[model samples]
Target chain A: MIGLYIVTGVALVISFAFDRKKTWAGLKKGWMKFYKTLPSYLFLLMLISFILLLSEDFIIENLGQENIFLGLLFSLGIGSVTMMPGFIAYPLSRILLARGVPYMIIAAFVTSLMLVGVVTYPLEKSYMGKKATILRNIMSFLVAAGISLIAGLFYGELV
Target chain B: MKKSTRNYLLFSAFLIFSFISWLVQYDFGLAIWDNFLVFARDMVLILPPAFILIGLFDVWAKNETIEKHFGKTNNPMRFIYSILLASTTVGGTFVAFPVANALYHKGAKYSSIFTYVTAASLFMIPMTIMEASILGLKFTSIRLLASIPFIVIGAIVLEKYFEKTAYTLPRVDQK
Candidate 1:
């Protein structure tokens, strides 16, 4: 996060130096964009919080080491709704792996955790419109499921 | 409906839901509240820089530059470059949207935009390292390798489908 700040700061400085008017216009655009999306994003976060409050325990308990079907469904639900950061998600999945959770389930959770965003669907809709956003998300879900199946089958006994 | 009105309706729904959850259980309400605040903090921390970068790119990157780099009619290098650029980003897919939109505005091709979003969402250097360390190198490698062809094919398919679809997708205007 600090790195992001530093880079943006430097870029801002360079932009200002290059063209003051353009730099100001850019900053204004950035602010407007942020403001315009703030409400939808807040709503999304609230929705996610509600889902997390309901499902946090359910996920840890029900995502067993067997039953690919149930695990996939559970993981998909968990991953699609929650937008946990990579740092927390990877470690959490690692702990699940250590606890003998099915690799397939964990893989699906992790893959969809990054790729598919049910929570952020509205945000995506604004950019890509309704159809493309839905299509991309469906494709992403399939990709995540495909990766999980492959990982689970190949490393069935190994892990 | 106006976007603002829709947003407010969603926010009201959230508030009502939280109130109902609170009535059911105090702790559940508290947990939801805390999580909401945490996410709000995350947004404050992450989004400004992302938007700033997007704005800078919008202001600075010429249409010709975007086109020259990502506008190839049928070149493998365009896909590779797009994927490479996307994979280097160290943030979530939400952050990528503005940049991708900016690129689209600047005349980038749909296939390139598709590849960029796919790579950004699925793979990144830091994410890859984290995955390798947690999931082991073999699992990471397999998933990574498996994703490449799927992403490419999916992008191509979407491009073709978009051409025929009733809802016109966004396109770069010729300058």
Candidate 2:
């Protein structure tokens, strides 16, 4: 947490320093502008609600019973879509694990859920350009896989 | 960002996602090579409506009012509020994008919006706690710690690229 804060601070300073005028004003004028956009935030909440409702069934079935690979694939698949709130995903995941899901697959699912979502493609395209969005998502997805693989190995060693 | 009024587009996407999710469940329910296709289908269907709503927000929101409050690129508070709002949030990543994008258009700095995305991605308090218990402190800590740099860097890059476009009203003097 602290490292992230420090990094964020440093990055903010460096980014602001590049275009001093825009950077300086962004601290104030920019934020107030964001405040006006609060209603947009609701979209996220709505998405979460939908996922929680829909995935309840999925979670009930697979809890405490997943392997690392399956978890990974589940995460990747879900992450690509962009739905499934952490609230729903985590509990469902825990249940799946308790039921018999492999650790690797659960780890994979968590990574994918957080790292990538296919549904966001259009929005990403508009905001960051299509190529940038695609490349970034791809890299993030790959990282998710790597993380799951390492996690599975570590768990195996510990047990 | 005018409303596309293409209601059918969103409906179609929703139906498609639903079908895909169903297909994934059926194909991999027992075999379990990877059930990603199911989740992907589910998430994709939800985005079209999210996009349409975002388009409306973008078109209707007053840029001036936004600039007056949250348009600061330098203020630390900008960062504070962004993380607060985003980290506290829970939702699908796909749906979150356009809403954030709309805010960006209304003058929210890219850095702030990026923070929102990153925070939202990992903001589940209970989940973190559970992860620590199940996965151990070392694993959870390592993952959380590593994510910070990624989030900060991602936010920084986004801010740089998303230069604010001055919002001017129709037939009004450019301020």
Candidate 3:
């Protein structure tokens, strides 16, 4: 996070040095972009918090007992809806692994958790349009599913 | 409904839900509020600088430069460049989407833009290191390797589909 600040500060300094008017323009543009998206972003975050609070325990409880197909499906479903930082997600996955959740299911959960974003749909659509957002997310879901299966086979969990 | 109105409605609905949860279970409501605040703080720390850098890029980056590397060219190298760039990105998808928007406006091909967004989520260096340390290097390596081909292929297919449908990005309003 500090790295991000330093880099942005350095870039802003250089940009100001090169051209004052353009630097101001850039700052204004950035502010506008940020402001415009602020509402939806807040809404998305609130929704995620609600979902995570309600479902986290339920998901953990249900995830452990399912067969491979059902496990993968459940993981993908939960992963798509909830977003978390790597620190939270990775440790959680580690705990699940210790709990004897299959490697492939964990793989599915981790991949889809990062790649698929149902909660991010509004933000994505604003940038990429509806069709592209839908297509990209659907494709990501499929890719994540494939990755989990491959991981399963590689670990010799699946014959 | 108007966008602003819709957003306001959604926001109100969320607040109401929180209120109801509070009424039902005080702790559950408090937990939800804390979680929201935590995420909001993180976003507040990360997003401003990221957006400022993106704005600078928008103001300074030459379209010719983006086009030469990632434009409509048939070069497979663009995908590699996209992945490389994605790996270095800091602020996750929230930041990635704005950067991708700037790139698109500057003439990057759809395939390259898609690759950047998808790879951005998967390949952040810090995230990968954490995953490796927790999950084992083999698991991390396998997931990364497995992801690359799929990301590339999915990007290409989505690009082709968009092209076939004549899909265009929603117009970003400029004030």
Tens digits of per-residue lDDT for model 1, A28-108: 777777777777787778787777677656667777746668778889777977777666677878878887887778888
Question: Which lDDT tens digits does candidate 3 get at residues A5-107?
Answer: 9999999999999999999998888888888888778778888788777766776787785578988898998888888778778888888999999899889
DockQ for model 3 equals: 0.72
lDDT of 1 at B133: 92
Show what share of the native A-B interface contacts model 2 retains: 0.06
Off by over 4 Å in 1: A157-159, B6-25, B166-175
Question: In candidate 1 chain B, what residue range of length 10 has the lowest lDDT sum?
Answer: B166-175
Q: What are the per-residue Cα lDDT tens digits for candidate 1 across B78-151?
A: 78988888886656677777677778777777778788888898888878888899879987897888888878
Tell me the tens digit of each residue's lDDT in model 2 across A1-159. Answer: 333345446655665567566444444333433233222233333343455445567645543333544545665666555455454566666776666666566666777777775655544554455654665577567666666666666668214
DockQ winner between candidates 2 and 3: 3
> Which candidate would rank higher by TM-score, 2 or 3?
3
Question: Could you list the chain B TM-scores for each candidate?
Answer: 0.80, 0.53, 0.88
What is the Cα-based TM-score of model 3?
A: 0.94
Count clashes in each candidate, considering only residues at least 3 apart in sequence or on different chains: 0, 61, 0
Among all candidates shown, the one with the greatest DockQ: 3
Ranking by TM-score: 3, 1, 2
The digit string of per-residue lDDT tens for model 2 on B15-131 reads 566567567775432222123334444444444333333433444458875555457636656666766666534333444554565566677766766666656666545557767
